[model samples]
Target: MKADPRGVLTGTHFLDGDHACCEGALAAGARFAAGYPITPSTEVVERFASRVPKVGGTFIQMEDELAASITLQGAVWGGAKAFTVTSGPGFSLMMEHIGYAAMTETPCVFVDVQRGGPSTGLPTLPAQADMMQARWGSHGDYEIIALCPNSPQECFDLTIQAFNFSEEFRVPVMFMMDEVVGHMTEKVIIPPADQIEVVPRRHTRKAVEDYLPYGTNGDGVPEMAHAGEGYKFHVTGLTHDEHGYPNMTPATQDKLVRRLQNKIHDAIDRITLLEEECFDSEDVVVVSYGITSRVAQRAIEMARERGLKVGKLRLITCWPFPEKRIRELAATTKAFVVPELNLGQMVREVERAANGKARTFAVPHAGGSVHRPEDILKVIVEASR
Candidate 1:
């Protein structure tokens, strides 16, 4: 709980969500950030811009989200860990480049501090409406790691995890944050520098002339060598072979795409992170993520006190949805309830994972409001009976 010499807290301190996220990215070893100012997410960039420079990092505010995303990609290729922060509208603008980053297997974090709806619907309000979009926002069949955090402290912790996942899988990771959590001020415990496990991108110790940019070993992750490191390499959106050069042949393209997808899917059991509280004895399970999970947790406790068998699964990684865990719960639990600030986006995933073994229901709320624990408890009580 003591403050580090740097004045960052090792335990809990009252801090805004934006500052927590910035600190998390820094702690995760991010060396560059490029972003354009957008509501509900601007503070994240602002905080990073101020802090990054102090740590010998680079922060640039680009003209728009497209440029911001592209700039981060360039920074990553320049041998620095990089990221960008934006909201709904800006995320839409960044889609094309996001697809590019995915196709090229770039390791970077994109923080989406979610606001409401299509085209800036509720700029300052909380909404998990982008849950589905985070999975398929960019075109094509590439894999991505997306994490959602329910509290300010988690906003710090999971941002680090997001970067680690991105680097490990060689994919773009999304940090999904709702306005409620992004703007709220709460107690956050920043761990000591040594206590935090920082995962840097894998680089080769092989001789410069022997390096192949996309050459994979047994686990399918290639050692990445940046440009200007005296390592000749090619990077592009087009399907490329192990050397990173474009391969237009259908067979080669197929191999490239499949590897990109499978590397992530095969690691799903390992990459999927979730927290289950009181999962074993429950007849009904409340599935939620981000801030909604907090509500669901309270609801489960109240339902249990009322002699109802209820538990909660807090999704830490939203993308590559926790199918294995959900399947296990489906076989044992009687019903599953999902609550989100948006309507039915994540509940669909829950139902798919449940596979008809348990009834899946959604409690959706939007327009600056959050689902209350009493409302979630009511559903749990009904399911328990």
Candidate 2:
């Protein structure tokens, strides 16, 4: 294998998910990150701090999670590819900044290595309780991209995708990883930089006089103008217009907010990613994501061994919830079995999308560990029947 001129570590190696996440950010051209130390997630930035300097990147240890979250956005406005990392309470603290990122249309990433939650629940344990929070943690009417990785390799690959989505949509992206996936060690194959595809920031080419900070370039997403670029533009968390000025009128608010959301909602098909196994005529479909998807696989196999027609849908992009696909499957499948670390967060989405067409069963766990294969199998068996 040839060395990557871009300084990416291009090869296969045994690495835990947190470490692999750092490598992914690096490979994706993330040159700046701000983070505060937090369990199950600190390692992502810890590795980044150590490894980034060699690749011409910078990692700042912020005073707290809020600071860490906002700082990365500042970095983005200054023309750097940036992200931040946290878990549980830290993630909660960053909600305000997350909303600010949304309102300002900052292109950045936030990695949440989820542990058991509800305020300092379990620091070292695994849980998917943050799924809803990732979608709605910040108040308001906005859409954000979120990717769930069930393995170390995905941790590497999806982090890159996370940054790319942030750039493509000009929105903050949530890279949701449970503690199990964060700490679990596995082989990760990182290809050469030349093999990697990165989306460059959509910087405005129009003259400073011609640029509107929030103006679109055909696509709903506005072209960004970095600070110190001889272009003048304002950014605020409040409702703003094409010039990025704060405009509190209902009409301005309506137009700005709708554009912010429609840019994502309209392109849902392109943003969603899933790994699926279909049966010719399946009786049930098992829906899962992150580490729980791995556990669900075992349960799926157990049900299959018993001659059950159980299909699988593993969510790679959790947000922009794949309701269309779920609704389509609802028409044909008898039931949907969702097994997740939290007590039925995503199952609610499944239930809503199913719209009573098919029965829905949620196999929920409290999050110290993953669910037993037999427990999920029982649900799948029940759903099949």
Candidate 3:
């Protein structure tokens, strides 16, 4: 596939988390970014604000996170791939509007560079504490696509994937990162723009008179036409019908909600991505994500040298949890160790998927740093014995 001249190509080079994320959004063909400057995640907006104009895109720093998020929604409605970046507090402030994005079937990317949480915990420190919140931060029942990156390269790559998924599914995709990945400097070789595959938002070719904003075909995803592109359509948070008009009727609400929810939920097999190493023969599995995956991998290698039957399942996409794979591994593995920087946010989902068959344990670290390999190895050894 020819890379979009606008996309980032593959290679290795060192870059800070924020820069790589900005580059990823650009490579994904994002033409607009609106965000507020918050610690840890501030650099993401700073970099994007400076670079977006160079690519003929718009980047605005709103007065606050709430405004920033809603601005991104407007940008997406205007026919541009849009995004925003924030930390825990800012993310909290954006939750109501995030719910609005979800309810409206808006396609946009939200990059949350997590720091210590619950008010202003730690501005510069890293934390994976936002895992559960990312899944249910909003008020209603909705599905989210979130990707966590362990390295600067993965940060860039996954940011692009987040945009693609959000556009394809018409949902808000969160690019979940920590201050560690956000601030760390590493070499990241950006591929030539021509090598990146940028997925554009699906548009209907029908005439303006024939367009239906929320009308669905076989796939539950409604064909969307950009505003001002000759398609007069209404978009609101209120329950509506296929034509996008306001409909307070319960039947219309049920049908609209079910279709919106099913469009992504039913495509679980297609949306979830996981990486399993030494999965077949291993009796013990170490499940990890983000920067913690690196520690888990090292622990697995050390355990292997000590004659321990340990493997790993590294989650690339955190949301729409890989329940099927977790179940399969749980059926065979003796125990599963989940090591994370938080006090066990994602482990709950792992346990649920394990269905009591696999004994799940969590090795958690609070704010500021990642779990060391030795700590994870200790858990592995204990589980093996």
Candidate 4:
């Protein structure tokens, strides 16, 4: 076992998904954070608040979710990797800032431990209802990355991946978790600091006079200059020019928005991550993510036991929606069975991607609890037939 350093507890230990996520952020060099307290998601920042100071960082419990969301972006511009955690209604409160983060190309992470919700739906219970919200809750035409982790270990692993993706693309990355996964305890092994890979911020190498806060050298992502390093740069949410100044013209909006979306769209192949178990003759494919993926796996096994040919596709990266892969699979697969904790969220994506080439079956759950394996298996059996 490697010795623990600064914030890395470098060994195996039992941890809930929230704690593991905090450790992942620390390991990924998140030196600052700001968040408001909310159930199922509060422990992530509670641990962060306790751990960050020892590592020469800061964690501020902001007045509300909106303040917490924007404060982290301030920390990011000040040259620190940062994040915020929230659940349900709190997640809804942060939408405007999420759009701001996208407009300004802020590199930060938002850890949303989802719970049942229309308004204060189920604070302590599980739900995958936030899937579509993570992608489109924020008003705007910009793009962001979102990841779903089904276990404690993945909660640790994918949070680091989330931070890395944010820095790499200079966009906000959503770390989506459900209450069940967030509170589920399991063994999570933390690697030594030296062994962990952290993506450093893409600071500008140009002289102060030569740097433009939003100026890019061809690849849509711009080099960032710290807030107080004698770099005169502007940051705003309006349609902006390369200099980060408000332009507010149709031409500017078209150019800016398309670049924001295209930077991600062009790189979708590299960004999408999935775990698959498939056979050439499998007729039904179970498409799922987050904690529901685990439930779907059990259902898939039961279907196979009945001599049914079934495959599993677990989404580790949910946003940007693996359209090409689903389209390709639809050509050969007989049907797709999408089971989610929400009444029907990601199944719509499956139906869209399948494009009628394959029949689509949805197994919807209304948030308080996960679907029974039999429920999912029944859908699989129906889809197969």
lDDT of each: 0.86, 0.92, 0.86, 0.92
The digit string of per-residue lDDT tens for model 2 on 42-127 reads 89989999988898878999999989999999899999899999998999999999999999999999999999979999999999
Q: What is candidate 1's TM-score against the reference?
A: 0.95
**For residues 226-293, what per-residue lDDT tens digits would candidate 4 score against the true structure?**
87799877899989998889999999999999999988998899899999998795799999999999
Evaluate residue 278 in candidate 3 and report its C-alpha lDDT on the 0 to 100 scale: 58
Clashes of each: 1, 0, 14, 0
Give the Å shift of residue 12 in candidate 3.
5.5
lDDT-sorted candidate list, best first? 2, 4, 3, 1
Candidate 4 residue 263 C-alpha distance from true site, Å: 0.8
Q: Compute each candidate's TM-score over C-alphas.
A: 0.95, 0.98, 0.96, 0.98
N/CA/C clash count, model 1: 1
* Stretches of candidate 2 exceeding 4 Å from the true structure: 1-4
Worst 10 residues of 3 by lDDT: 1-10
Please identify which of the two predictions, 1 or 2, would achieve the higher lDDT against the true structure. 2
- After superposition of all CA atoms, the RMSD between model 2 and the true structure is 1.7
Colliding residue pairs in candidate 2: none
